[model samples]
Target: MRIGEVLHMNGGNGDSSYANNSLLQQNVILMTKPITEEAITSLYSSLSNPKSISIADLGCSSGPNTLLAVSNLVKAVDNHRKKLRRRHSPEFQIYLNDLPTNDFNTIFQSLPKHRREIAGDGSGLCFFNGVPGSFYGRLFPTDSLHFVHSSYSLHWLSQVPKGIEENKGNICMAAYYDQFEQDFSTFLKCRSKELVKGGRMVLTMQGRPSQNPTCHLWELLALALNEIVAEGFAEEEKLNSFNVPLYTPSLAEAKLVVEKEGSFSIECLEASQIYWTGYNGSDDYEVNSGYGVARSVRAVAEPMLVSHFGEGIIDELFHKYTEMIVDSISTRPETTQFTNVIVSVIKM
Candidate 1:
């Protein structure tokens, strides 16, 4: 699969689009927000404050969450500068990057409103641009970026792992864990070259619990796909050829990859669980949990599914997938846990 060419969140703010279905990713950003603030705070304190700061958000798909992260960072810097009694905070050159197919139009259209809300007076201190590319390789010039943030994105390999064709039943791509390790190391090396010395990065993505790397929400989707094949809704051959290019690494695995690359120092590593249907501090079960999961899944996975199975099967496939998720939630609510790994690294 040409992931950069085909993979993207659903475009626009339609009900099924990623703009509407990205609460999970939002929660991920929230989980890593404090770490990001700390990194940015340390960044300014460590160096003579430049007149401008360059920040790039990788895998910043079009959505509220994209600017939400940037806005928070800007606020953090502004607050920190005030506390330090600095004469002025630096202007920001913020880059929002994603696959070329991403819904950059939506991000661009929303920028005016976001700028107005964030900068109030429309000071234009923050310059925002959509950079269309993959983060697995070099996307910026050497020593150009002072800070980088990526959430819920690194899990997606540049392409499907090698030797993925051997798998027939489960499409988790766990068999190619080593492939993921190599790709992740390469990604870090590329970022290291782009970052200035002492620059920092905070990344949050799907991760596996060390005790049980086998557990994942994809298992349920695999089951649903198998059922579709059994019912002849999708061909067995097509199902066998299709595999999601996602890998949830354990914190240890992530650390090992960074260590092997020898460019970034691992400052912090954390593991947390986020429900597919995020808990809003409510005891009452959300009846719409299944639809929520289905929409989120569709936003990211629909392109791959359509390419492999044809667009005709999408609605029916997700309908059955949603039903299965609802039934599982009713019977085994614990299975809804989605592990998130957050890592903060500094370029050495």
Candidate 2:
């Protein structure tokens, strides 16, 4: 997987708009709510047999968000253990997973603060350094983990959105989709191998309905950045350089992939139209709610805008697109959207 994709907009240390305090709260709330519903509840139930419980977060980026996941998992397991009143506390194993280049330092730094609570159960949280080498291969010892949770991640293909940068046309899209299917299938197959009997996994990723494809979101993003390229705010090379790493995988595509993987029964699969706190649901606004979504494109947009329209034209160009989105939003607030998919599967 490309390091940039793993690092996407949420690398933490404050540069990321979504990592800010207000947004992090919402993300935590959204992420934690579902863990109680499916395989996670079952995972907690297994805490009665202490040795049977193990929880992990897949694609956990460095930030308070990942730590929050760890803490919540531990608390959930503890709750289950208490109800059962078992003598042996479930041994906690936390797999701090992500691309190798992930900011482990930040993740680690945020951990010690929880040492007291994490150590309260006597059997402290075990931190594993496994970085699922590739999405297509097994990362854990067989039957090692009881629960796996991934949030706001995993729509990312194992590599850059292949051929989109080169504008490879139909051939590019077809090749990329083929690779997505193959890689996702391999990922599920490999995950199936490591989960213990009756274990479960939950994945929250961005998605689009097969019926209502939203390819225009990408077009909007591209247009949003065109101003940065036109102005000196961002680089032209960067504009043409990177892609979203994913184009909303359809629910049908997701279901087809899950169906082929064995011993994994789909529990709950849903697609919800969700709002991004940072974006004002307007296209023309460069920065919304001080979240600075436009700043994200600055890395690439700055140089491109300068090259295409000279140094000073960027602001105006960005303004033009921003206004377009704002006007668009006023016209279609309900339809102005982003989609997320939630799927939980249980092992046989």
Candidate 3:
């Protein structure tokens, strides 16, 4: 996807919920819904019992997802407070953070009026604070946050890996993997300082350690683009400009990096593989529901598709791509697969 398109996809906000909100109800909710609750309950016991608490949701794109995630955190904190036997709930400074280019307009407009409705009375004190630039850099005051949460967001790197743009051999392609490691470590270091001692964090991101992070996902993306290229669709140059920043980390790699970030104990690790079965098994979601996800993968395919296929067969290829998904799901596996890792850690 072009930078402009990516900006449009990431920043814009609307009702992108899948049919019946199945994405939330069937899969994403099962994996990420409770980490916030588990982390908050465990974290509250370790804290010094402060009256005002701070928390943030990193990479919180503009949409209902952000609100739902925030709601998850709020519910967790509220449940924990009850155990504290405190009638006066602490002030919660919750920051909904994401890239500056993100559509704050949509996010701000869509924010819920009653954050506490599901969890009951609590002064959420919600705030819209853009990370402004990048997650690899500082976005808040020192030791300012009590808890940090990010979901299906951190797996994306700051930008596409270098040299992959040039289409060099695997040598250059490896840049994506190297970059993911560097960025993740940098993120930890940056986040470490912002968190108070014992601050807690929950993150859910897509990954596949068994496959080469540098190649597999991009290869799949490339294959998808190839079809578009063969049939002629978008411009090839635009595709070349896009890149995904994240690399799926192996279990060992994830543990090593967090351990290096000073003192952090990995609390929970789970595998969540998912299939993007759009409403009624159709691909029209590219224009609506899948917009954000589609934009995220654009860099992986656009340039190759356009450059290879030119402009004649774009639509034809997309049709083939869509059908393939349905066909694959209907076959034997029953559903397509995506491997995800959910990690919870505490800074000591």
Candidate 4:
């Protein structure tokens, strides 16, 4: 299956939409805000007070998180300009990019409010355009971008690995390091061409601690699928044929790709753990009950799931998935976390 054709977060403002259920990704953006701001400041300073700045948020899926990232970056750059005592902030040409099938209309609908908020802050004229395509290939003119930001996006491969047909009963792409290396390397090469010399990029994606690329949360989902298949609600062949086009690389793996690509210098690279529920405090009863986690997964995974297994099993699958998640958390709370890798790089 073509991942770009079928892959997208649930659209619109419905309860199951990615806009409402992306707290985990939102938390990731908040956690990495410091790095993002620092990169923008450093890049802006190096540019010697350029009159205009071009920024691209690759793989920018729709929702509040999308605008949140842009707002943070704009604020950071504007604040830095104020620190420099500039008379006026630079004009911003912002590009919001994702697959052709992404929910761009939803993003556009929120732009008036976004523009009003930015305008109120006196951040100067900002231009926003939707660029629909894959980041695995070039998306902009050479040396066109000054700053690039992507959060919780790069872990998705351009496509599922060619081999691994025998990777049945397991939906996670845990054992595909070679494919990840190739995809990540391609990503770096493409970005290197688009970003101007000294331009900065900050990326935050799911990662793992050790060399093992497995994600326990995805494993739990696999278990849920297997259970449903055993009950004859879905075909076992369909289960066997489906492999999630995702890879959670270790820090070492990511560092290796950047160094080998040689088009950028690593500014910062680190991994932090995030709770599966995306909230550490017990203030939210739904988050604590594991329903939030299930909903989050469904929002992202349902499109691909429906594409392969039909829509009939989605409610049942997630119902079972929520129960499984609750049981797993009760028995092994330590494993109820995802490792996130945030890397900042400068174009050489």
Highest TM-score, which number?
4
Tens-digit lDDT string for candidate 4 (179-289): 788999999999999999999999998999898667888998999999999999999999999999999989988999999989999999999998877555576444465
Off by over 4 Å in 4: 278-288
C-alpha lDDT of residue 194 in model 2: 90
Give the per-residue lDDT of model 1 (tens digit) for 1-348.
677777888898887899888898898888788999999889878878678888999999988898988888888888888778787778999999998999988889888898878787332399987898888789999999999999989888877777667468687765657778878888898999999999999988888887465654678788888888999888898788888888889888888888889999988888999888764444545457887888899988887888778888888888888888888888998888888888899999
Q: Compute the lDDT of residue 271 as modeled in candidate 3.
A: 71
Candidate structures ordered by lDDT, highest first = 4, 1, 3, 2
Supply the TM-score for candidate 4.
0.97
What's the TM-score of every candidate structure?
A: 0.95, 0.76, 0.78, 0.97
Backbone clashes for every candidate come to 0, 22, 14, 0
Whose TM-score is higher: candidate 2's or candidate 4's?
Answer: 4
lDDT of the candidates, in the order given = 0.84, 0.60, 0.60, 0.90
Q: What local lDDT does model 1 show for residue 241?
A: 80
- Find the candidate with the highest lDDT and give its number: 4
- Give the worst 10-residue stretch by lDDT in candidate 1: 278-287
Candidate 2: tens digits of C-alpha lDDT, residues 273-339: 6553345556544346223433433322344334433666555655565565555555655545557
The best-first sequence of candidates by TM-score reads 4, 1, 3, 2
lDDT of model 4, residue 296: 93
The Cα RMSD of model 3 versus the native structure comes to 5.1
Candidate 3 regions off by >4 Å? Answer: 1-26, 116-128, 168-175, 209-211, 214-220, 234-243, 278-317, 332-335
